[model samples]
Target chain A: MNVAVIGLGLIGGSLLQALEAAGHAVTGYDADPATRELAEKDGRNVAGSVAEAAAGAEIVALAVPLPVLPGVIAELAGYDGLITDVTSVKGPVRALGIRRFVGGHPMAGKETSGYAAADPALFDGCAWVLCLEPGETDLDDWLTAAALFTALGARVVPATAAEHDRAVAEISHVPHLLAAALARRLVGNPLAAALGAGSFRDGTRVAGTRAELIAAMCGGNATATREVLTAVIDDLRQRLDELSAADPVEALIPALREAGDARRAWPPKPGAAAEEPAGAEELLALGRAGGWVTAVSESRVTVRTMRPESDRITP
Target chain B: MNVAVIGLGLIGGSLLQALEAAGHAVTGYDADPATRELAEKDGRNVAGSVAEAAAGAEIVALAVPLPVLPGVIAELAGYDGLITDVTSVKGPVRALGIRRFVGGHPMAGKETSGYAAADPALFDGCAWVLCLEPGETDLDDWLTAAALFTALGARVVPATAAEHDRAVAEISHVPHLLAAALARRLVGNPLAAALGAGSFRDGTRVAGTRAELIAAMCGGNATATREVLTAVIDDLRQRLDELSAADPVEALIPALREAGDARRAWPPKPGAAAEEPAGAEELLALGRAGGWVTAVSESRVTVRTMRPESDRITP
Candidate 1:
């Protein structure tokens, strides 16, 4: 397989390294001259420009930041190869209507960024989401992309752009906003800041992320993020109302128990073995059911379903 | 100094060990016979009853759960010793009107509880809050408790019952509720659960805590927790509204930056040398300013104030 990864930042550089290490012929390109120079100096196949990278490549992965994505996508207009992206948000990219493009977002990252911090093992054992846009995405191209990520030891999750966006909004984008909001409350409250222990530290950890990056991710998925955030606000408001009740503690116990049960039951144990997905709908259904694709072929798709235990959170 | 620690749970047991390790004659007691046997078997001086532990002790520390606190306090009714508590919520305990009682809450804990998980060094470098009720607290007794915790390598922060409750609500109780709410959202959304990474994991870490414990902490500090949680909900609501705006990304940046600044500025660095607190009023002021007592004596109280450096979260 011939691969081209553009915008040689952490994800791009890592993909280039991982794909190359997986015996794929890889070429990488970055907008910054110094990054290209560094990759070239590191014995990587460094392309001078987007055209140079995409030329003669069977697959092109645009790993540029969200703001630069439209321009990069525009530059790949005439290219006939399979296209994918590593952006956190997928809805907007999917709306671009690019042929042979399967929007992707790997659920993996580090606190640090840039080519210097790239590691080939970054996506290992991580969920690499491939947006299987109904009626749009080419099955062959999607499978090729899934196979590439699977080869790098990633679990490929088949989802539509809308599903991907909503899921991430619930899991990633809204969590960032909530963290920021929680951290913001600490302002002018030095005592509270001082008293912050494990809960505050962990809850607000993502608030320490780069502001611009968080803004891009959350803001880009505005609709889904807003919906989820509103729901959270409503849930909290209900809890607040309960706090005013005659017996607030008693009123909160059931909700807390439910949450505790859900939390403790997370990352559900893997089921017996990989089962063949009937079709694309089944593949997407499996993903929504907390299952991941282990292998994809011309004839069948294999996935491991998560089995949630009933008595997991109970004492 | 002779100390009697009532309750042999994690905090109580750890306090017993830490105090004994600091060369204090510490005797421990618990309501559970099994816990008493375990403590006695572990070579700790375990008292069969609260009265036995309280007898011949100059300082009595109530390290019991919130529900058992009133009964424990009732048992110590006419004892003329310096009484202190390690309950998370101080307002209710302060309202108990126990003479010679000083409300205290140590901002340190482990995920696991019980006597078996006790560690002598648990309070090392942790903030041990000592409530100084403006008109009710005895200066000598307050100083004695402060000195004891200071000797255990804990930073003693002088706070009022209300102040401690509010601070913990902002930093601890409310965060617990938020984590629970976040975790609760994943109840049926397995895809979101599958996509959950560091942010979700960290944000929901405390949700995995004992539900009853969380309920007690949040509920015991109901008023303060509700206020803080309401504020958080409002902030999130405003962010949600911003997401509906034309330039949601631009609208959200300033707030995110502020939060990022606050989060990064956390835990402001320790200020200059330990300055002498003027009086009880000054000591309370230092605690509110995020300063902790390094030493306490008949003449002076030495504290190290946190110095938040400028340009911390800024690039």
Candidate 2:
């Protein structure tokens, strides 16, 4: 397979190296001249521009940052080949309605940025989400993307753009805000800051991320992020009210126990493996059931589901 | 100095070992026979009861769980020697009005709790808070406790019980609740659970803590926790509303930047060292200013303050 990755940043550079190592002819490009020079110096197949990169490629991966995505998307107008992106947010990109486009976001990253920090094994054992919108996304292209990621040692998760956005808002975007909030509380109270230990450090770890990147990710998916943030706030506010009650320990024990049980049972254990020739809806169903695609063929998809006991949410 | 450490769980056992390593005559006791036998087998001076351990000791340290603390406090009804506690909450213990008592809480712990997991170096480089209520606490006892913890390689942070409770709520207790709330969000969403990565893992790290311990710690400091939690919720709510605006990225950039700045500046760098013969009021002021006691003598206390530029909160 011939692959073109635009924007030689951390994710893009990593994908290029990983795909090349997996026997794909990968052409890489970056708007920054120094980055392209670095990649060229490093002996990667560096393309001068997006057109030159995508000219002979079967799959074109847009690995640019969110702010740069629109211009890149516009530049690729009328190519008619399979396209995918590695942007964190999915809804806005999916709404672009590009022909044969499959939205992708690999759930992996590092504190460092740029092509200099790229590693071929960054995606190994990571969950790579591939958006499969009903009646919109091309199945063959989606399968090719899944196969490409699977060969690089990533488990492919199938979902619609809406599901991807909401899931990430719950797991990623909102968490960044929560971390920032926790970090902000330490500001005027130096005594509290001095007392911060493992819990405080871990809770606010992501708060160290660049502010602009967090704002763009959370703001790009504002509606979903807001909804999830509201739900979390509601849960916390209820706990606050309970703490204010006459018997806080007794009032909050049941809820805290439920949370603890759910947390302890998390990243649920994989159970039975089932495979069948599946369409878009079927693949989405498997994903919603806490399952991931172990392998994908032209006619069939194999998924492993979680154990029954661990699958259910604690009531 | 002679010291008695009661309750041989993780913190108690670790404190006992650390104190003994510092060359104190340390006698330990636990209500559980198995724990006492384990300590005795380990060549520790294990006593059958709290009374036996406290007998003829210059200082009695209660390292019991919060629930067990009241019982131990009751048992020490007539103890006239210097006393201190390692309970996370300090207000209730300070309110107990025990003579010659200094309330203490070490900002250090491990996930595993038992005598077997004890380490002599557990408190090294950790902040051990000692409560010094203005008129209620004895200055000599407070200084003695500070000297003892400082000798054990722990920084002594002098604060009033109210101040200590409020600070912990902001830094520790509330962060635990936030981690629990974040963990609870993944309860029913398998897709979200699969998407969990560094941010989710770090943000929810403390959710793995025992539910009962969390409930007691957060509940015991209910008033302070509630106040700090409400402030955090308010901050998050403002961000949610900002995300709903016409230009969310623009609306949220300023607040996010401030938070990022605070986080990055965190741990304000240590500046000049100051020494003075301080009383309870002066020591409390130094703690409030984020200065920690390095050494304590009968006449003077040596304290280090943070760099001026990093000490101010981002406006």
Candidate 3:
């Protein structure tokens, strides 16, 4: 398949490389001449302009930042091609004046960006989210984009634009904001943070955020982000209030157990935590949940959390 | 060196295997006779009681829940041993307990726990935090625990319990509260959540928490946890209020930029905001302060403020 990728920075560069490596013809386009030059030097096909990139491409991957997608999409409206974006939030992409585009966001990443950090296996075994507008099915580029995602080993999930926005707001955006905000307090405190452990690192791993990109995302998706953050803050505040209301505050343990259970429920893969390896304690948290018997090792299994109230080490 | 592991559950069992692997004579102990029996069968030297575990042992690791640490400390009052705990929080542990114990928490973990998940490498390259009491230098066992942690590839830093607590609250526990509380809103909205993307997962990952544990942590550490949560909520509320203040919210993007910068300035890693490996776009929350540059490879990188402003991606 032939692909035209917009934005040529980290996501675009990686997508171009991945597509080309997978035996697909790929062309890259970016507004920044430097970025374009870098992509060209990297040996991927480079386009002089947006139109040239999408001229005859089967799939168009808009690797532009979310804030820039609308204008970029408007530029591509004249082209008749299957279009998708590697943007995080999907709602605005469709709601905005984008044309001939099916929203696709691949759940894969690394902290570092630019063409240098693009990993070929970035999207492998991850969820590739596809959001479609009501009348977007007939677009051939949408189908091609979905195929490209599948070829990259991502499970394509179809959703509406609003659904995508709200979902991301709830999960990705809110966490990033909280981490950033939380890390703010660490500014002055030395002793507290100097002895900072892994939990702090893992929790605030996303603390120092990029100003421009986040500002753009927040500015564009403020409504959804606000709603999601509001709900999250409320939930957390309520729990905290409940703890404050409790006598002797014995509720903290149960809270940890529940929090641990919840955290464990989500990531079933290895290398999920910031610094910890795949742990036997994850099963211990589950065992602490109830009679949920899980094998820690092939032979040395230990059960925990007999009932929800207490944790007994099962010999 | 001989090691005695108290509370033969996840941390305990893991300690047993880890200590054995590290060439330590490990004697495992648990209050539960059954757990002790299980430890005996699991191929570790199972001690009959907490005293037996601590008696003549070079190092004693209290791998129990936070709320129970005081009782464990009380039980250890007579024994002259170097003590450490694997509990996530340290403030209460130090305040409620005696000396001869170096408060060490390995910033290592998983969502799961128990003997099955136990591995020696769980502590590899992780931060094993050590909090010094008023007179930490006098304890002989302190050096033993520190050596054990150092051997595990963990960077040992001395800190106060309050410092450790606040740090963990900011980084680990607080994040858990955020994740769980955020997840709660989605519990009833599974359909919407089912359509959710990577951001949703990343944000609420800790939301699938252990109910009892969360309850306990919040209940017991309400003062510290509430303080942190309140700060977070208050900060957000203020931002929202400023955002939706009136018709002229001119300072919206600037405010977001400041917030993003705050996020970037925190945690001060090589690339703060850029470190987020998964999501829609490059989420630059705060300018440079937040260090929140998590590249969401899928969907949209949604950002929110109370105002109705949109970011203009630089052309």
Candidate 4:
């Protein structure tokens, strides 16, 4: 496979290294001459410009910042090869309406950025989202792009561009915004800042990410991000209001329980297969919805159960 | 020192073990007979009643639920000993006005609770807030309480009851609500639940904490908690509104930078001395103010400066 990754930043550089390690013939280019020089000095195949990088490649991946991607895509529109991007948001990329272009976003990153932070193992076991619109890329090109990412040790997930945007808004973009906003609350209080512990650190860990990158992501996916944020604000406002109710503690139980259930339902290890509960068969025989018995206290027995097929499927 | 720990729950049980480990004559009691029996079976001094536990003790620590602390304190008020608590909020505890009572809160816990989850190392490297009113505990008692917590491997921080409540509202209580509310947003989204990764998992980790415990904290400190939540909502709304601006990416930079600064300023390893920065002196000399330099990018250097002395000293 002949591959070219343009814009040699963290994602681009790491993708180049991973592709080359997987035995693909790879060329890389960056608009920044310093980045290109660094990659060239590291014995990587460095191209002088976008045209030179895409010249002989069967696939071209634009790994530039989110806001700069559309312009880069436009520059390489003449190329007949399969094109994809490593941007966090997919709606704008899909809206570009470029032929042979399939939007992609690998769910992997660190707090640091740039060419210096790139590593061949960055995409290992990461989820690489592919916006597989039938009209955009032919079946062969789609399969080729998916196969390339899989070979790079990513779990390739296929979804529509809209679905990708919505899911990312809920799980990634909104969480990042929430983290940043929560961290900002501590800015005025030095004592609170000094006394922060595990919860404070873990909750705001993503806020320490490179500012421009996060800013671009939030800006690019503004509508979806804002929609989630609006809903979140309403939910939080209701929670705060409930704190003043006659039975504040009782009123909070349902919301807290739902949050706990949703959190526990999330897979601990990403990309791992959902495991079958131990003793699931016996529990199913005794109850309508059942799985394994997780714990037992003096007053109650706690069992974790999966919903029945009837209950799981909505009307 | 003779110590009595009322309420053999997670915090109480852990305090009992830590005090006993520190060579104090410790006695434990719980309203639940089963908990007392379990502790006694484990070779602990499990007293049958509050009277038995408080008898001949120099320090009596109340580790019960927030609402129950006042009642327990009232019950043992006749005892001529220093009374303290491990509640999350301090204002209400201070208002109890029991003789020799100084509000105390251990800034440590886990999702799991009760004696079964107790460990002597629970207090290690955690911050213990002590509320010292000039008229309450004498100098000797204050020193004694501080020394006991320090010996249990905690960093004893002294603050007024009001300061303690406000700071905890900004740091712990409000963050817990933010986490639970964020997690609650994903309750109905199956894709978001499945796709939740490090950010979602870590950001919402505290939502899995016991509902009753968090409810108690929020309900008990309704004023401070609500104030922080209101301010947080305003900040978040401003951030969300910024995402829709003409230069959304640029607009998000300050918020992201502030978030990063606050997160970085949090003491990395808790209970350790603040380490001097490598180039802080140079930066301080160059600038009008000095603080922790949070992030450095290609174009910007972000620093978090303390408020001016006049501003910090509120009238």
Candidate 5:
């Protein structure tokens, strides 16, 4: 199979490497001559122009930045092949009205960007969203893309473009905004920055992400993002109001408990570092309460009674 | 030196262990008998009552929750020794007018609490804030407390109680509120949880922290916390309003760039995982840009000209 990837940056460069490793002949092109040179230096075929890359290719993937995506898509309108994108947002792209277009978003990214930071293993065990319209794209075409994504160690989930946009707004886009907001709050406070520990660092880590990329993403899906943000702000306002109640501490109990439980139950990230052994049933159960493992160690064999639910605050 | 720790939970238990390891004879007391038993089981000296722990102890450290701190201070009024606390907030505590009192807060904690999670190395290389008033606590007493904190492998930062509270509001307390708010948004959304990646997980990790503990900390410092929250919400509201602007993406540039720059320069957490080797200066420099090491790899040394600022989005 021949695959042509346009815009040889992080996602494009990485897709070139991974697709080639998966036994596909991959070609790449970028508007920037330096980026094309970088791809050639990485031992991948580099096309002189977008038309050259799209010629005689079975699949063409658009991996460009969101701001320049429309121009790239317009250039690729003459290509007669399966088309997909790796953009974080999908609603506006779906309205682009390109033939054989199937929207995709690899739910994976690093804090860094460009071909230099590209890794073939970037998409390994990651969730990849596939936006499909039945009347526009046949099942065979969608299946082909899904199979290729799976070959690159991705778990493909099929959804409509609107569904994908809403989900990304709640999970990815708004989280970035929150991180950036928190970092903005810390701008002039050196003492706070010096005192920021694991929690603060973890909470604001995403704030270091690219500014334009975030702007393009949030701007492209303004309606969905705004809707989610409105709901989130309303929830937060309710929480803030409770802080001024007669029994503020008592009022906080339910909200805190619910949030804690929801956060605790959220599935752990795939390929996350395993802090404990994977085999849980065989290991001695020290104790459990309120869905939290009270105590379990590698060498300890004593199994104590479970603590009360009130005592187990977090998992 | 004789030290009394009047709480045996995570912070108190760890303080006792670290202090004992630093060659101080320590006595511990807890309001709950179970906590005192846990301390005794760990082979630490346990006192029968708060008065018993305070009797003849040269230093009394109150490590109880914020709500009960005043009562604990009142109980120790007759001890006539240097008094300190481990509460997250310090302004209200400083107003208690206790003689020879110096406020301290260690910038180190875990989501999971209790004596079981306590480790003697918990505070190693952590920022420990010490609050001292010129006329209230003599320099000699403050120096004594500072020396002990230094002995336990802490970088002691001396500040006024009000300064400490304001900083904590921005860095620690408000971050918790944001995390809780994000987690609350995720409560009913299963697809979002399944698709949530590193950013969402890290941003909301603190949402799983104990409820009562957060309530106590926030309620204890309501004035400072509310002040910081108001500013943060204002910043967020301004950003949100820009989503509807004529050129939304262009408008997002300033806020995003400011956040990215601030987050980039924020000091890495003390004792964080060493990403690169500690001795980077000795190694041949590949390149440097904007206070960041542009490129360094073990494979080969290839130096390239830095890209323009507009093109260099993510670091």
Candidate 6:
């Protein structure tokens, strides 16, 4: 298979490497001649121009930024074979007038940006969003595009453009915004540098992402991302109100326990809470009560609060 | 040095293993004898009761939950050389009132909970917040306690209890709440379930944390957590209103761009604005010039609109 990858930076360049390792002929393109020259030196066929890259290629993989997508599509509209894009969001990308443009979002990235940070295993086992709309033309072409990325170890799942956007709105876009917002609050705060520990680093590690690219993503998906941000913020506000009126150490155990329980039951199970971590709650309640009724859930009353201040408190 | 770890859970168990691996004589206590028995069977530590574990030990580390902390401290208040506790938050644990107690908040943990998931490299290079107040206590004693954990490959940064909590409020607790709220939205949404690709999984990944624990953390750091959450909710609400009313493709880009720029500049160098992205205003100007900017930042702009949007409109 001949694969033509546009935007030979990180994602596109990595695809070129992976395709070559698989013994397929891989050609790449970029607007920057320097990037093209470097990629050529890296042993991939770096096209002199976008059109040259598309010449005689069986699969044209558009790995350009989301904002530049529509234009990239126009350039590829004349291509005769399968066409796909590795844009993080699919809705806007699919809106472009092009057939066989299978929308793809590879759900993996790293703190390290640029072609230098490209890795062959970047998309391994990662779910790749593949969208084909109802009015789309050439289904066989779409399948051919999907097959190429699938062979590269992506779990290619089919969806509509709307589904793809909304999914990312909830997960990718919203989370990225929150990470940015949270990171923004800390960047200049005196405690930021010293206090920015692992959890902070991991939570906003993606902050190292190309600022321009991410900014456009949030804006591009703003319509879909609006509700996600609102819902999250509302929940956060309510929780903040509930928690802040109290002290962290005095009130934290139960919250942490709840978070721990929720985390334990996630992804691995996909459904169902892991046996309600009854022990931690019980120990917490008992510890809170000092051998009496400490707290009660909606369904059950538990005793063990020893402090008079905590006496008669609902569990 | 002989070390006594008072709880045989994830953090404690791993510490016991690490201490022994480093050739330190380690004694362990888990009020639950079963845990102690397992520690023995696994050759992780010498099996002993709480009192037995502390006997003849130069260091006694309390790895128990905070609610039960006071009792544990009271149980071994007099026996100690540089006592420390591995609680996530420092305020309440410091109130445990041990004479030589030094506070530790290890900035590392797994999505998985408990000893079974404990990793030897858990604390490697991670920032371990050491909260020591002007308690009229000896600094060397607390520093001695810090040295033990530091030996295991942690960067120990000294902080007051209040500083530690505030820092965590911005980075740790707030992020956890955001993850939780995002995950909660998925509770009944079947669309989210089906559309949950890698981005969703990554966004809500930590949302799977234990619920009660998170609840407790919120409760514990209630005030600071509330402050951060309020700011987050307010900012998000404004963003929501803007995007809800405009084309996500247009209206949302500027806000996200600015935010994404600020987020990316974390742990900034002096005059970081030289690295600053194009602000929204600049991007707006650029967009007005037919560039069709998707995101605008302080010094950067992501031109999402294709060049032909002009041709399409004019023709």
Best by lDDT: 2
Interface RMSD of each: 0.9, 1.0, 7.0, 4.8, 6.2, 10.0
lDDT per residue (tens digit) for residues A98-173 in model 1: 7788899998888788999999999998899999866778777787888789879898888999888998988889
Candidate 5 deviant stretches above 4 angstroms? A34-46, A111-121, A134-140, A268-315, B17-26, B31-46, B95-99, B110-122, B133-140, B268-315
Model 4 CAPRI rating: acceptable
Please give me the DockQ of candidate 5 compared with the native complex.
0.26
- Candidate 5, residues A1-315: lDDT per residue as tens digits? 899999878888899999999899999998999888888888899999888899889999999876687788778767889999998888888887878888889888776889998899988877777776646655556656766886787766566677678878887778888888888866756567657776678888888888987888887878788888777777767667777777766776788878888788776333211122312221112111111122233333321122223333454
Among the numbered candidates, top TM-score falls to 1
| Poorest lDDT segment (10 consecutive residues) of candidate 1 chain A | A304-313
Rank order by TM-score, top first? 1, 2, 4, 5, 3, 6
Give, for candidate 4 chain B, the lowest lDDT window spanning 10 residues: B286-295
How accurate locally, in lDDT, is each candidate?
Answer: 0.84, 0.85, 0.60, 0.73, 0.74, 0.63
Maximum-DockQ candidate: 1
Query: Which digits, one per residue and each the tens of the lDDT, describe model 4 over residues B185-301?
Result: 666554455456888888899888877777877777888888988988998898887987898889988889888877766553222123222232332221112122222222223
* Candidate 5 local lDDT, residue A250: 77
lDDT string for model 5 (B1-315, tens) is 999999988999999999999899999999998888888998999999898998989999999876698788778867999988888888878877778888889878876789888889988867777775545656556556766776787765666688778878888788888888888766756556657778788988988888887777776777787788777777777778988899878888799899999888776333211123312231111111111122223322321122214223354
lDDT of 1 by residue, B259-293 (tens): 99999988777655445653788888777777778
Q: What lDDT score is found at residue A295 in candidate 2?
A: 70
TM-score of 2: 0.90
Q: Over the stretch A1-315, how does candidate 3's per-residue lDDT look in tens digits?
A: 778988877677778888888899888898998888887787778999898998888778888876587678777866876777877777656667555667777767777888777777777756566665555544234335555666676544455667667766666666666665666665544334434444455555554556455555554567787787776666666666676664634544554455455445443222211111112333223322322221122222222111222223345
Clashing pairs in 5: none
Supply the DockQ value of model 6.
Answer: 0.18
Classified by CAPRI criteria, candidate 1 counts as medium
Question: Isolated chain A: TM-score per model?
Answer: 0.92, 0.92, 0.74, 0.79, 0.79, 0.70
Q: Write the per-residue lDDT of candidate 4 for residues A211-257, one digit (tens) a residue.
A: 88788777888888888889889999998878788887787777888
Worst 10 contiguous positions by lDDT, candidate 1 chain B: B304-313
* Winner by TM-score between candidate 2 and candidate 1: 1
CAPRI category for model 3: incorrect
Looking at the true structure's interface, with contacts defined as alpha carbon pairs within 8 Å between chains A and B, what fraction does model 1 recover? 0.80
